[model samples]
Target: MLTHPSDPRRVLVERSDLDPMALPPDLRRYEIHLRATFDWGRAYLTNPHPDLGRSGSVCPFVSASLKRERFFLAVHPGTPSDPAEAVDTMRFYRDWFLELAPRSQPSAQITTILVLFPDVPQDAVEPLVDDVQAMLKPEYVGQGLMIGEFHNGPPAKSGLWNSDFRPLRSPVPMLVVRHMVPTDYPFLRDDPEQARMYLELFGDQVPAQLRDQVERERAVGAP
Candidate 1:
C-alpha cells in the first residue's frame, strides 16, 4: 500500500500488491470492487479477444504496466454528485499521477492511475463521470496526458477497431490517467487545439493517415 504524498488518507495500491485483507478496516469495504477491477484488467485489457477486431490486446499498455508494477488503483474516498466537485477530484489525481514514481521516460509511458468510484450510483454515471471527462479532457490533453472515463453505463466511446465494442465499460465507475503517446492521435484529431497539441508532442511521428488532418488543423491555427 502506497500512501499519496500530499494526502495520507488517499491510498494507492499497485496491481501486484492488491490484497483485501491487508487493507485497513476503513478501506476493507472497497475490497470487492477493487478485486473486480483487477480481474477485469487481466481478463480483458491484457488479453486479446476475437471481438476486439485487432491483433493486440484491448489495451496495448496494460500487460507492460502490470508487469512493471506501474499500474495503480485507488477507491476515491468521496463520491461527489456535483460535476464541479467531481472535476476537482479528477484534477487532483491528474496532478498526483504526474508526481508518482517512474517519472522518467519509457517506464513512465506505461504508468497508469485508475481512480475508482464505488459509491457513485448507476444513475449519476453520465453527469459525474462522463461529463467530468469532457470538461477536463482538453486540460489533460494539453499537458500531454490522457484522462478516460469508464462505467457500467457502458460509455459511448467505442473501440478504434470495432465500432460496436464499448471498451471503456468497466465493472465500476472510474477515471484513468496516463501519459499521452504517439498512438493517441485518434482521440485528439477531432479537436483542433488538442490535435495541434498532439502534433507538437509527436511531430512527424503522427500516423500518416492523420497527418493531412493535423496539418490542416495547424494551418487554421488555435481556435
Candidate 2:
C-alpha cells in the first residue's frame, strides 16, 4: 500500500462512520457481496482462461497479492452536470489514481480501486472510463498496477470463455484497480500495441509455455 496520505475527509471509504460497508475491517461486507453476486464471484473471478492458467480460478492468484492493507475502494456517486466540469473531475481521478500506487514499492498487490458512479448512465460512464484508461495506461506500463471500469454499460466479452457472459458487467458504474500479470494477454490481444506493451511489461516473468502466444502477439503488434 502507498505511504502517501489521502485526505480522509473527501473519501467515503475513510468515513466508515457514514457507510460501514465502504471498507469493512473484517469479512462482513465484502464476503456478503461476493456471495450475493454469483457472476462476479462464481464466474468471473473464479473462472480462469484456458489459455492463461490451465483451469485454476483467477481469484486465488489475485487474492494472494492482496492483504487487508492493500485493499482500496472509492465510491463516487455523481458525474458533474456540466460537461467541462465532468471532464475536470475525470482528470482529477486519473491523477489521483496514478498516485494511489505505493511510493516505496514499485509493485504491490492488486490494490483494487472501485469508483462507483451509480447515478450516471452507462453512456456517460463508458466514455469517462475510456478517458481515464487513455490518460493513465501509457504512464503505467511495467509498473504492475491495473485499473478497469464497471458500469451498467455493456458487458466486456470474456477473455477466458466462449460464452457471451460479460465478467465486467455490473449494476453500477464502478472502476476497479489491481496488479498486472502476464496472463492479461487475453485482454490485450485485441489491441496489438497494448498486447506488445503488456508483454514488454511482464518481461521474463511470463510463463515458458505461453511464450509462443506472447511472441505472436508482439509480432502481430509490430509495425
Candidate 3:
C-alpha cells in the first residue's frame, strides 16, 4: 500500500510480512527489533501487563493491527543524528501512512506505522527521537493524526492509569503514526491549540466523560 516507491529513506514492512529467517543479514536487524519491541518483550507495547493499571493491553489497538495486517514497521535506511533529518524521515512515513489503503472509518483507525531507527545510539534517542516528535506533533495534530516517540531510554511519559509506569518505552528508537481517536484527548488537553484542534476534529464525537475537559482547555485560549 506504500505509494511513495521512489522515496528510499525507509522500507515499509507489514507485521505479517516479517520473517527473520528469510531476511538477509543486513535487513535482519529490523525484524529482530520489531519482534523484541512488539513480541518477545514481556513488557511489550502489544501485551497486557499487571503494572499497566487500567489497560487491557499496553496499546489496545496493536493486537488488532497485527491480526489485520495493518501494523507496519519501516526500517530507516540510516541513523541520522540531526533532528531535522529525523523529522524529515518521519514526515515521509506520515505521508505514507495517510496514503495507505483501507482509508475508511474503523479500519483506518487500526492502521499504524512504526518507523524504526535500529542503529541510532541510545544516548542520542532523546534528541533524535523525542525532540523530533515534539517538533512535528503540532502539525500532525492539525492533520488529525497522532505521532509518538519510543525508545529504550527511561519513560518520557507516564501511563494514564499508573503514574510511575512508563508506557512509551520500547526496545528500539522509533516513531509511530496513527489516526487520532477520540480517546486521545488526554494527550492534546495540555496544549490549548492542540486541544482546540482535537475538539474541532472530534467535536460531539468526543467521549461524554471528557467533553467538559476538552472544552475547558480550549476555553483557556492559545498562550
Report the number of the highest-TM-score candidate: 1
For model 1, the superposed segments whose C-alpha errors exceed 4 Å read 101-103, 208-223
- In the range 148-181, model 3's lDDT, one tens digit per residue, is 9888685479888888888787778888899998
Worst 10 residues of 1 by lDDT: 97-106
By lDDT, who's the top model here?
1
RMSD, one per candidate, in order: 2.3, 5.9, 2.8
Q: Kindly give the stretch of ten consecutive residues in candidate 3 with the minimal lDDT sum.
A: 1-10
In order, the Cα lDDT scores of the candidates are 0.83, 0.52, 0.77
lDDT of 1: 0.83
**In terms of TM-score, how similar is model 1 to the real structure?**
0.91
Error of 1 at 126 (Å): 2.3
TM-score of each: 0.91, 0.63, 0.87
lDDT score for residue 46 of model 2? 50
By summed lDDT, the worst window of 10 consecutive residues in model 2 runs over 9-18
Q: Which stretches of candidate 3 lie over 4 Å from their true place?
A: 1-3, 21-26, 40-43, 101-106, 218-223
